[model samples]
Target: MTTPANRWRDTPDRYGLISRLLHWLTAAQVILLFGVLLAWKGFGEHPVTLLLARIGPHGSLGAMLLVTTLLRAIWAYRQRHHRPPRPPGVGGLLARSVHLAFYTLLILIPALAILRQYGRGGHLIFYGMELLPEAEREIAWMMAPADLLHSPLAWLLLALIAGHVAMALAHRLWLKDGILARMLGSPQATRDT
Candidate 1:
């Protein structure tokens, strides 16, 4: 198999180098994790317990998302480096904030969930090994705040993702703007298209 070139294009340039990679990669992980979580929760399984069982083996993958999210956040702070289209205004600012929140919650949700499990004498499976802690916990009371954070914030993330997709579509249809295309390498009419 051949490797793809470092992809770029002028006009509302494709989310820049780092942003594009982080955007898609985080998207995939979020969707997978979203499915795992919704399946577990919608079925009335204790979300934490269910995740501890299912997502336990995917610890490293989750960690990767965390790292990627951080890197993406940093890149987002300096997006002008790629010199893309004109940035968004107040509306865009709000939308961007929502997206950032979504990313943050994704990282915190799994991490705290796992740590909650560990603190509560639960098993974490990574690479098919029962990745349990060797050190014992003296206090058994765990999963309290993690459980509190799980449901409500999860619902919030659901809304954010929905709105994000809707905004992208709005940009495509209503705004007739370059928002979506720029992210996907559509040919633009101008350098800052």
Candidate 2:
């Protein structure tokens, strides 16, 4: 039987509890952030949009996501050797590339926002507590990357997320290869990989 401690660490076949928790939590946050943005764009000044806004302010959610993504990335690196092996050939390469892209955007999107915030001499507030103090003056250079790339990169990240979800569903429903199960199922679950 797997011990309680063992359940918290990755094995060669499946992700551990911490990894799964982080993955799902991050997914939830992303969904909420995007959903709110979409609702605001679609509904204008509707009550539902206001409610969603109250639930998750973009800046606060972005800050939280930045911290979560950093932690998840660190944990993934530590668990890399213990996690399940990837498929061979181009399949593995594609998988790695997509994942790397996800991490890149996940880290960069909020980082750029924070950089822009700092450049504007604004405090970085998360859940009402200030993390970064206001600056003395706006630094145009520091804000330029975000000003130019933030919206476009955010749209790209959303597209990537959609593709990621579709692939996971394909694995679960069509392929029946247990790739999705490796992340969603219990550690004891048997996976082909």
Candidate 3:
């Protein structure tokens, strides 16, 4: 029942409880982050302003997300993932590459988003509490280009997330590969039978 991910038992791909907890927590946070993005864009017109006003400026939120993303990315590369063996062929390699890309985009986009705001002379408020800006307001003049980069890059990350979800569904419904289970469900999910 073990996947290639876990094959190297000596390597510790079987995450400790704390690491697993962090992994799942960050995963949920990332999903919520996307929801926040959706609301921000969708509500850009009228009544949504009320909600966003309450949610507060994105500079702080994006900065917080960027920090969390960096921490998670560091934790991930620092450990191993206990994955199962492939059925064969290029599909396995493709799956692994996609997984890596997900991690990459999550880290990159959040950081870039913050940089975009920073360029606008705004500082991260950290959940509405006033915080000093990392750089001079004068530097926001340079952030304009970052805004241009942040928008299109955001969409690209969205596409990557969609593909990630699609692969999970495909593994669960069609391939019967247990790809989704490896992270969400314990290996014992199959063995319990």
Candidate 4:
């Protein structure tokens, strides 16, 4: 009874609508964030980055991503026992490790950024609304982890995602498995077992 309209919950055989939405939505946001960063680095204050800055700053995007990431994590926990079975082997272990890393970085990067923002006496503002008020003075200790890890960790996350996509492609093309289809296609399109 997993019709397209009613696939909001996950099944043991495939992902449901909510998971797919969160997955793709988060992917899009991360891609945009990377694009903005790349543009900022290559063309420091180019019109495109300036225009995007006007619409929403990178901080706001990170906050939004954090929210989505939390929701995804919660959903994943609730569905932990309901997800598809992994193929038992080293590949499975690697997949699980990558997923754990993804979840960790998704939560950690923004968290570190928020901490750094606070330590620097800057408010954590989202869409121009203040979430965390600025501290009266800079706290070097609060800001150190972000200073050392944020950029590097973000790049590592991007690399992991690239590998994740490559594996999914491998599942679709080389393995002839329906792993990718579970996220991208209807129930009928995926292999049930």
The global Cα lDDT (0 to 1) of model 3 is 0.61
Residues 1-193 of candidate 1 have per-residue lDDT tens digits of 1124435312234554456667898888777666765566577567565665465334655655677787777767766555454556887678667766876887787676677777676676555666566337634456676767866876787788888899878878787767677676544443323
- Report the C-alpha lDDT of model 4 over 1-193, residue by residue, as the tens digit: 6776647878766788888899998998898788888878888998988986666588998998999999999999998887766668998898888899998999999999999999999999998899999899999999999999999999999999899999988887788777877787445354624
Per-residue lDDT tens digits for candidate 3, residues 67-174, read: 666766666556544334444679878867876776776666666666665666666567757665656655654666566666686677778778878876887788
Q: Tell me the spans in candidate 1 whose CA falls farther than 4 Å from its real position.
A: 1-12, 40-61, 74-80, 83-88, 129-134, 138-142, 187-193
Ordered from best to worst lDDT, the candidate numbers read 2, 4, 1, 3
Over the stretch 103-181, how does candidate 2's per-residue lDDT look in tens digits? 9999999999999999999998887898999999999998999999999999999999889899888877887787888
Q: Compare the candidates by lDDT and give the number of the best one.
A: 2
The lDDT per prediction is 0.65, 0.89, 0.61, 0.86
Better of 1 and 3 by lDDT: 1
Instruction: Rank the models by TM-score, top first.
Output: 2, 4, 3, 1
Worst 10 residues of 2 by lDDT: 184-193
Model 3, which residues run further than 4 Å from truth? 1-20, 45-49, 52-57, 81-89, 134-137, 188-193
Instruction: Give candidate 4's error at residue 23 in angstroms.
Output: 0.6
Lowest-lDDT window of 10 residues in candidate 4? 184-193
Report the candidate with higher lDDT, 2 versus 3. Answer: 2
lDDT of 3 at 46: 58
Clashes of 3: 12
